[model samples]
Target: MRYKNLIFDADHTLINYTADERDALKRIFEEIGLKFSDKMLDRCCYLSEFTWTETGLYDVKNERIQREYHNLYKTHLDLLFTRIFTEFPCSFSPIRAGELLLKYLKDGTNSISHAEETIKKLKTEKGYNIYIATNGLIDIQVGRLKRFAPYLDGLFISEELKEIKPNPLFFKKILERLNCTVKECLMIGDSLLSDIAGADGVGMDSCWFNPKSKENQSGTKPRYEIKDLTDLLQIL
Candidate 1:
C-alpha cells in the first residue's frame, strides 16, 4: 500500500534456475562427448551453493560456470577437448561453450517454474513498477526477462553495475538510478545475504522469498517472508 516500486530477483524467484542449470550442463557435456555425471553435478552444486559465503563471490555473474567454479571435471574436459581428433572429431571452443550456456539460459523450455501469470497480473492489474534485481550475469538475466517476463519494467543486475547486493552500494546504485526513495521500494529475493541485507541497509522494506526454507543463520529480519510467490499478491 505504501510502496511505489516493486523489485524482484530473477533466478529462483522468477525463473526456475536449477532445472536450467542441469540441462545446460548436460548440453555442455554432450558437446564434449561426455555424459552428465552425478559426481560432476555434485561439485558444481557445492560451488554454487558455497561460493557466496565460502568464497565471497556472491555478486560475480557468470556465463560459463566451469570457468569460475573450476573442478576436476572441467579440467578433465579441457584435456579431452585438446585431442579432438581422438575424442570424437569435434571441436571445443570456449566461445561456443559460452554461447551454448547463454542459449540454455534464454530457452524457456529450460527455465525453472515461474509465476509468470502472477507477475503479469501484479503489474497490469496492480500498477506496480516491476523491476528485476538479480545477482547473475546481465546478458543472461536480461535475455530471460525479455523472453519470459517482458511486462516488467526496470532491471538492476550486479554484472551491469559492477556491484552485488547485500553490499550497500548495490542497493544504492538502484536507488540512484530509479530516483526513488527507500520507503517507496520493496526488495523481494531468495538470498538473505544479498537481497535482504542489501535492502535493509538502505532502510528499505524487504520480502524474503524463502522457497527453499533456508535459514539466514545471520539473524537478519526481512519485512515479510512467504513460501510461495503467489503469496505476494496478499502483501502487494
Candidate 2:
C-alpha cells in the first residue's frame, strides 16, 4: 500500500454531522418548549457555523488566535446556545439547553454513506491503520465514534491535543503518536481548510472528500479529490 496510515476527518467525511446536528437541534428546541421549524434549524445551523469560525476555530495560521481559541474551547459548548439564541427569547436556561443538545448529539452515531464499509475494508482488507482526526468536542466525538471502535486504530481530537487543524503542530503531534512519517499517511476529509491544508502544511498527502461538488475557492490544494468514500479504495 502507498499509505500505511489513513487519517480520516470525523465530521462530514465519516460521521454525518449535519444529520446529527439537525436531529440534536430539533430535540433541543422541543425540549426547551420552542416550536421546531426547518427555518429555525437553518438559522441555528448558520449561526453555529458563523460563531465557530468567528471564534477562531479555523484560524490556522495565527498563533495568537490559536492560543485564544484553546482558552475559549473549554466553555464553547456552555455558551453555544446563548450565542445562537441571543435574538430569540427563551424561558429555559441556555446553558441547560446546550447540555441537552450535547446529550442528544452524543447519542447520534450516524455515519456517512459507505463510511463504515470503507473503513472496514481499509483496515481489514487493505491492511491500513485507520484513524480519525477531528476538531470536535471530545465528549461528543468520542461517544459518536464508539461504533467505529473495531476498525479505528486511534483517534486524535484537537480538544484533547490542545491544537487545532491546519496547524503544523497538530499534524506533527499526530505523526509522533503514530510513529509514522508524513509520506506514510494520507488525510482524507471534506474540509479543504482543516484537513487538506493541515496535511499539506505538514508535507503529507491528502484527499479532499468533496461529496457536494463544491467549488474550491480556497487556494490550498489536495493531492487528490473524490466525491465518494469508496473512491479512496482506488486511490490507495
Cα distance off (Å), candidate 1, residue 170: 1.4
**Where does candidate 2 clash, by residue pair?**
none
Clashing pairs in 1: 16-112
- The worst-scoring run of ten residues by lDDT in candidate 2 lies at 70-79
lDDT of 1 by residue, 1-236 (tens): 78989898787788777677667766777777765467766555444454333443443333233234323223333333343223334456744655565677666454334578778877888888888887666666777777545677788877677666666777899989999899999998888877788788889999998977887685789989988887888878
Candidate 2 per-residue lDDT over residues 134-193, each given as its tens digit:
986788889999989999999999888888887899999999998989999999999988
The local distance difference test score of each candidate is 0.69, 0.85
Say which candidate scores most in lDDT. 2
Clashes of 2: 0
